[model samples]
Target: MQPLLDAILHGGPMARRRAMAKAITLLESTRADHRAQADALLTALLPHTGKAFRLGISGVPGVGKSTFIEALGLYLIAQGHRVAVLAIDPSSSVSGGSILGDKTRMEKLSVHEMAYIRPSPSSGTLGGVAEKTREAMLVCEAAGYDVVIVETVGVGQSETAVAGMTDMFVLLQLPNAGDDLQAIKKGVMELADLVVINKADLDPKAATRAQAQITSSLRLLGLHGNPEHAHHDDTLWHPKVIQISALRGQGIDTFWAEVSEFRRLQTANGRLAARRQQQALAWMWERIDAGLKQAFRQHPQVRRLLPAMEADVAQGRVPASTAARILLAAQFGKAPETIE
Candidate 1:
């Protein structure tokens, strides 16, 4: 553990990248001993973490997210910033595997000495993020990456967890996105700190229309959803809409300018620190809930009765709620009759 820590904290660039990968892999392992060591490593890395700006990017499947990310990453690297991209690829439910082809997609940035890209399988985790993505971000930050980008699996609506964990959430859209009212209705749009219309060069007029429509939608949502936003406070950051052509590498500088402005405003208002505090508490509760569920499943009594209860529920002999109650009672060492 000490050697891995040393490599990650002080090794040369190649060794540091290797150590980061190994540390992230350890964090992803399900073995009990691995988990203990991962926890210790995380504790040691905590002080070095949080220095980097965490940026979360998500969009629908065909929105050219990979292209946009590669362009932005290269642009940042050229400006002397060390960039780390944590790309989440969806896992197959049947086979529980992912193609993990982000490295190939981001050919130049992936091989750059100043950039690190880690493609993680979602592994049945919802919200379009991998289970250990936050841990991986910490590893990258500890390794001196000043900009960390988390690219989600591009699942449309339910792709929201990234916003909670990231300092900024940028949602990508196609030029034709505004043609459907469904885009405005998606909950993911409400969470976006900035909306970028990618591939705008394909249809400039359509992109302009989308920019207007989305800007209006965001304004209306803000007025109705949050009183603070309704006031249009300059101190508080409201979502902005911008157009970009990632394929042509246009508007990347403009996008970065908006990001810088958002960060400046967030820092000035102290919301950045407050947001991190809230996220830390939320992460703790999320982990607790997950741990409790795992413990419930592993409880000897619950495991012993689970098969019969599942059969009963499947046959409609027992209600699922009742079966759940009975299992909970058994896990707590109470008689099943006590559940009712």
Candidate 2:
């Protein structure tokens, strides 16, 4: 563990990349011993983490997310910034497998020495993000990557999950994305720090319309959605809309300019530090919920009763609520009636 930590913190580019991959793999492991070591490694790396900018990007499928990310990543690298991309690939629900083709899609950035791209399988995890993505991002930050980008699975709606973990959440949209009332729905758009219309060169007219429509929708959300999300405060960062052609690399500079501004404003307002604190607390509770669920399932008494409870519920012989209580009682070694 010490050796791996040393390599990650002080090794050459190749060595650091190898160490990051190994560390991330260890973090992703479900083995009991591996988890213990991964926890220790994370504790050791904590001091070195949180220095990088965590940028989360999300959009619907076929929105050219990979194209845009590749463009942005290469641009950042050229500016002397080391970038790390944590791309989440959706796993097959039935087969429990993933293609993990982000490396193939991001051809140029994947091979760049200043860029590190790690494609992780979502594995049925909700929120379009992989379970270990946060851990992997910390690994990249500890390895001295100044910019960390988390690319979600593009599964739409529930994709808002990435926003909670990232410092800045940028939502990518297609030109036609604003053609309906869906744009005003209360979800991902409300959380965007910036909205980008990608592939604008394909249809300038549509892009312009989308730019206007989304800008309006965001304004409405800022006014009516959540008080905390309101952009009316001049002191706080207001979300902006921009058009970009990621395929042709147009507007990449403008996009970065907006990102830089957002970073500056957020940092100055102390929101960046506050947001990270909130994310850390949220992460702790999320892990606790997961741990409790795992322990519940693994409890010997609960395990013995679960199959019967499931059968009863499926057969309509027992209410799910009652069966859950019985299982809880069994796990705690208490009388089932006492639970009710």
**lDDT by candidate, in order shown:** 0.85, 0.83
RMSD of each: 2.6, 2.7
| The best candidate in terms of lDDT | 1
* Model 1: residue 101 alpha-carbon error in angstroms: 2.5
Compared with the true structure, what per-residue lDDT tens digits does model 2 show for residues 137-194?
8899999999999876555434556787789999888888879746544577778899
Residue 313 lDDT in model 2? 100
lDDT string for model 1 (1-340, tens) is 9999999999898999999999998988879999999999999999999999999998877688889988999999999999998865554444342224656778899899889987764456653244588889999999999999987655433356678788999999999988884845358878899999999999999999999998998899899888799785889999999999999999999999999999999999999999999988888888788879989999998899999999999999999998998999988888767876
In candidate 1, which residue ranges exceed 4 Å CA deviation?
A: 92-99, 127-129, 156-158, 183-185, 307-323, 335-340
In model 2, what are the clashing residue pairs, if there are any? none
Please count the clashing residue pairs in each candidate, in the order shown.
0, 0
